[model samples]
Target: MVVATRELPASGYALEVDGRFKAEFATRDGARAGAEELKKRFPMLQVRIYDALTRAREDVQLPRA
Candidate 1:
């Protein structure tokens, strides 16, 4: 599983996982908050964050449960 954020000019950011839209955030902080939520929801999977603007992708580091 992977989570990503796409920037929206008017709305802020859009969160997605596996090519599906999961949520919309009003700011970068909100998107990061969404990422944390995703980590909590899927601890066993390899979650990641991708920045559409930078074209960079990295795996999400989940805290030990």
Candidate 2:
């Protein structure tokens, strides 16, 4: 039996909700915008942006009104 393997893009941004990957974007700004929108809609849920290349995660926090 033969199996095929899939590889992730070398550089891209991903949005994670509650420690699970929700979506991926081509640009960092896009990912940030998505995270912000999700955070606004669900204030109790944890949102973060992950960098595929750097393997880094940044937490998203809402601004105080």
Candidate 3:
């Protein structure tokens, strides 16, 4: 039997909601865009973008009403 393991890129970005990973993107802009859309649909959920290279998390602020 053979198994395959997926490798993630060093510059990849990850979208996190409420401390849980929701999606992954090849670019930071893509991840940010995804977070924004999710924030728009669910105003109560906490959205963030995580950088795999720096091992940091950036909080996404909601737009002003």
Reference-based lDDT, residue 52, model 1:
53
Give me the displacement of residue 48 in model 2, in angstroms: 0.6
Higher-ranked by lDDT: 1 or 3: 3
> Cα RMSDs of all predictions?
5.5, 7.0, 6.2
lDDT against true structure, model 2? 0.77
- What is the alpha-carbon lDDT of model 3 when measured against the actual structure? 0.75
lDDT by candidate, in order shown: 0.55, 0.77, 0.75
Q: Given candidate 3, what's the lDDT at residue 38?
A: 85
* Worst 10 contiguous positions by lDDT, candidate 3: 1-10
Q: List the residue pairs that clash in candidate 1.
A: none
Model 3 per-residue lDDT tens digits across residues 1-65: 01111333356888777877767787888888888888889989988887989988899987798
- How would you order the candidates by lDDT, starting with the best? 2, 3, 1
Report how far residue 35 has shifted in candidate 2, in Å.
Answer: 0.5
Q: Which model scores highest in lDDT?
A: 2
